[model samples]
Target chain A: MMSLRLQLGIIFIMLVVAGSIVHFLRRKSIDFRYALAWLFVDVVIIILAIFPRAMVWLSQILGVASPVNMVLFVGLCLSLVVIFSLSMSVSRLADKVRKLSQEIAIIRKDVFDGDNRVREEMNNIKD
Target chain B: MKKLVIIPAFNEEGNLEKTILDIKENAPAFDYVIINDCSTDGTLAMCRRHGFSYLNLPVNLGIGGAVQTGYRYAYYHGYDIAVQFDGDGQHSASYLPEMAERLEETGSDMVIGSRFITKEGFQSSSLRRLGIRYFTFLIRLLTGKKITDPTSGMRMINRKLMEKFTEEYPKDYPEPESVVTVLSEKHRVTEMPVIMNEREEGSSSISLGNGVYYMVKVSFAMVIARMKR
Candidate 1:
């Protein structure tokens, strides 16, 4: 039986892969930069998932004498934070651009449709 | 149909009422919008007091950002023709109809109200004139469009071009920079000769020091605009 920590890492990796697949299916238009970012994130999670013994080797190399599981857990936690921050930033920028475009479209429609009711209101002030 | 004029005002409480009245008097068929660029002054209060249908920007996002706000407003509000009228009381409302008519006849994306096109009454400083000439040459060399008055803010934009502007507009001093942006998007932009008056009150937002900054910002924006897709 696998250690509890190793089992959690495997489950986390599975969740990420499943999430990425769902995102890809929904968007249908995935650019290279985002693809590369997700690829790096997924690869790191997979490495931590499959090779559980490699954690001991990494801990020894990093001069951490604590149990291998603790070292691996800390490393994985740090990686998760960094990846999540990066993904959030990219998504935020994308959202801003999308919102800007939508706002522009709405304004264009109003202009062409002759909805100058505001002007009429202003004209009423002349009385 | 009535014309929609977008005047992006940044702390121009002194001049806003006059400019607004000028449009109302001279071009009654036209409606105007004032985009307040987060003025700490009583500009917003004045707009509210006068009951002008204006947009209040949350932060001070320079001239280009403010103008883009006006374009976005014009795009959604339903106007036959959109004109960029300066809030400094420099642009006359009388010339608005001609610009709008030209846009309708020629099907051009944008029609600039130009002072450089004719020797008829343009009294700008020599330094600004020199800068305008340099930008005009740069535009011709790059976009193959023989355009003058690249820095003139008084312009009439059609629905199609207004839509493009609302989508994505340059963020710094955008007059010259946006000419290239408009042209690169396969849109036709031209200039018409017009009389330009000097500002009656208030100083310009951009200082002499900002001239160098403007050139660098425009250069980068031009490069980005040239990119395909």
Candidate 2:
């Protein structure tokens, strides 16, 4: 079982991290989908803090030296997941930007040419 | 069949006019569009002044994105055949009709213009040739298809492959990777002997400094491309 001071400390840090994440989400500084991952990590830590006895039992079964090490290991895994997701999002956004730029260039050419076959088709329909 | 020549240009202000003229003289049966990839030079102005059919990308998309944009344009315009012609004055337009003819005669989905086949005209530097040979060997090993000049920018694709290219293409140094994609799908590919000219203006995009990166990235991409099926 964790001491009262350690339990309070863990809860305090996690609450503060969750608060900042929510604040950033509200302020639109970060995307909700991305912020949610951080919030999830914080929530897992808070749950572990609330149940230190459970963490100690699980750590023993998993061969961890201490409950704190167990918490750190879990946090590391979650952080890796978040970071990998961020890389995926970056690649997706780059692809989207490329496609958008290509489309915009084509549209600009259609507008510049003033001989849009579509416009001709529309006129023919009216006639 | 409606045919389109895709000329992807970047800061080719000195060479574009002549390249377009070469197309007009040699491949008059086909229409052409210049993909001006946000050239900081007078390329855009040249397109405007001559009233050339062009799509000016608002940003630089390197060679692959620029060529993919041309494929999209070809797809939307309903071109039955799409020819990729360089705007650097290195690729002669005279081979375009022959390429298209071979594509029809052999019923291949893609046709590559290979300088090594003829051993004629400006064969790139010895270092570049060695690099090409390595790629040729790698691709043949992976897909069992020989691509004599895997780095040639001049090629023609039928409507089916043109549509495929519109959906996805490599972002940089895409030639060898794209060939792998097509060949891995068990589609037919052909190569025609063609003479190429030395570039009259502007520097080649692939410099010696990043040659290693180019090889590693392209080789990885080709492996992934073959396995993507």
Candidate 3:
């Protein structure tokens, strides 16, 4: 059984996270796709806070020594997944930025030269 | 056939003028573009003053990114062949036409300007030569293709390979790894004998301290690249 103080602490953390997610969503700062992962994490935390016995039961089933250990293990795994996803996204963004910069350089040249021949030829080739 | 030479320069202000002049005087038939890799020097100023044909990268993309930019330009501009020539005055423009011709004659997708093939002209430091030899043996062990000068920056690629390179290219210290990539992709890579001069000004980007790191990193990349298939 979780102590009242521990339960309250978890509740406080859930509220803070939920508030931040709401604020981010309202401001449209993060995409819904990315926010969905955070929302899922929030839901898991809330569920664990409400039913502390679930963690105990999971801990017993997983042969872990304590519910706290189970919680830490799950948290570490989830953090890994989150970090891995973030790294993948960062890699993709880097590639996109690189491509954008290359295109910008080429387009800037075309614009400055007052000749659309290269641009036109590129578009025709793409077509 | 329209050929484009890519001169990737980074803070090579001292040599850029003479290099450009040499290309204009010797390899005038081939169109050239200087990729100024966000040099923190008078290189860009020189380009603007001379009104030289160049693509100025807003950010420092390193040598790989700079060369890939040139390849991308060649692809977009519909050049039949693209040659990568260094801006440090090390690569000879006189040999460029012959390199392009070798690419066409042998029906090879790429032609490398090799110094070791002739065992002559600026073979680099002995330690660097050892690293090159190690990579040569490693590449031979992995793939049947043997590259005498895998680290040579002077290379020419046909349009087909240029299209591929524009899409994807190695990031840093890319010369040797790119050679491995081309070979693994079943592309024909041949080498032509050429004499490379020592850099006229500025030090090489690969310093003595980082030489070991470079060798290890590039060798690791070469092995990992082979495992992809």
Candidate 4:
């Protein structure tokens, strides 16, 4: 069983995490889709912290040696999922950056060249 | 109908000017856009000095990205046809009209300027020729369409395929893999014989060390593209 002091410490950490997530959402620093994953992780942590016995029961059902080991395993798995999802998003962003850079180059040429052509035509008319 | 020629260049500082001038003199009707793929040379300076219609890519987006940029530009500009012309001065602008004519006559989605159709012009090195033949056989095996010059950089695509290419295109050694993409879509791809000149300047991008890797990688990309469709 987790001590009351340890439970209070976990609650404090959860509050800090939830607050940070809220701050990030309010500031629109992170997209909602990504924040949703982090928020889900915080909720799971809070639930596990609130009912330590639930984790102990889960460990017993899963044949884990201890509740602590179960918690570590779950944390590691969730972290892997989050990291994997982040890597996928990074890959997509890289592709978008490539396309955007290419489009910008093309548009820059169109606009600047148009301006140059008009200036040349004006000079030609003056001449 | 508006036709645009996309010349993708990488470190072709010496040859680029001549290539553009040749196009301007020979094929005055067709509009051309030079996609300067962040060359580590004076290519950009040359473009600016000549007031050439060129797109200076901020990053080095290989040949595939460079050509796709041209296609995207063509698509947005409402061009009816877009041709992928090389910046190295090997591709003659004189052949543009004939290729365009063939594209219209056959109503093909894409027309590739082939060096082997007439068995004339500067055929690539013997090893490169062997590799080309191997890919030709591989493409024929998968798509049942024979592409004699799968590695040729000179190609013309109609608006339909141009729109598709704008959405997604192969990245590395994209020529052969792109052929597979078009064939998988059941679009018509044909070849027109055109004479190619020796490179006016600059070294070829595919060196001997990477030749084998290029062949294997492109073959794998083609196979995977076929499977995905």
lDDT of each: 0.75, 0.92, 0.88, 0.90
Positional deviation of B1 in candidate 1, in angstroms?
A: 2.4
lDDT of 1 by residue, B60-131 (tens): 667777787777776766766788889898899988878887888888889998897675785588887887
Q: Residue A58 in model 4: shift from native, Å?
A: 5.6
- Model 4 clashing residue pairs (backbone): none
Worst 10 residues of 4 chain B by lDDT: B197-206
* Native-to-model Cα distance after best TM-score fit, residue A53 in candidate 1, in Å: 21
Candidate 4 global TM-score: 0.80
- The sequence of per-residue lDDT tens digits that candidate 2 reaches over residues B174-226 is 99999999999999999999999999999988898998899899999999999
True contacts kept of each: 0.05, 0.95, 0.50, 0.86
The CAPRI quality class of candidate 3 comes to medium
lDDT string for model 3 (B34-149, tens) is 99888999999999899888898887788988999999999999999999999898988999888888998999999999999888889899988888899899999888889999
Model 4 global lDDT (CA atoms, 0 to 1): 0.90
* Candidate 4 off by > 4 Å: A1-19, A45-69, A120-127, B116-134, B195-200, B204-224, B227-229
Candidate 4 local lDDT, A89-113, one digit each (tens): 9978878977998889978877987
lDDT of 1 by residue, A1-114 (tens): 247786587668667775775588569766555566556656665665566566566667777665446445655776677678778987677547545644553454456344
Q: Say which docking band candidate 4 falls in.
A: medium
lDDT of 3 at A10: 78
CAPRI verdict (incorrect, acceptable, medium, high) for model 2: high
TM-score of chain B of 4: 0.98
CA RMSD (A), model 2: 3.3
Best candidate, lDDT-wise?
Answer: 2
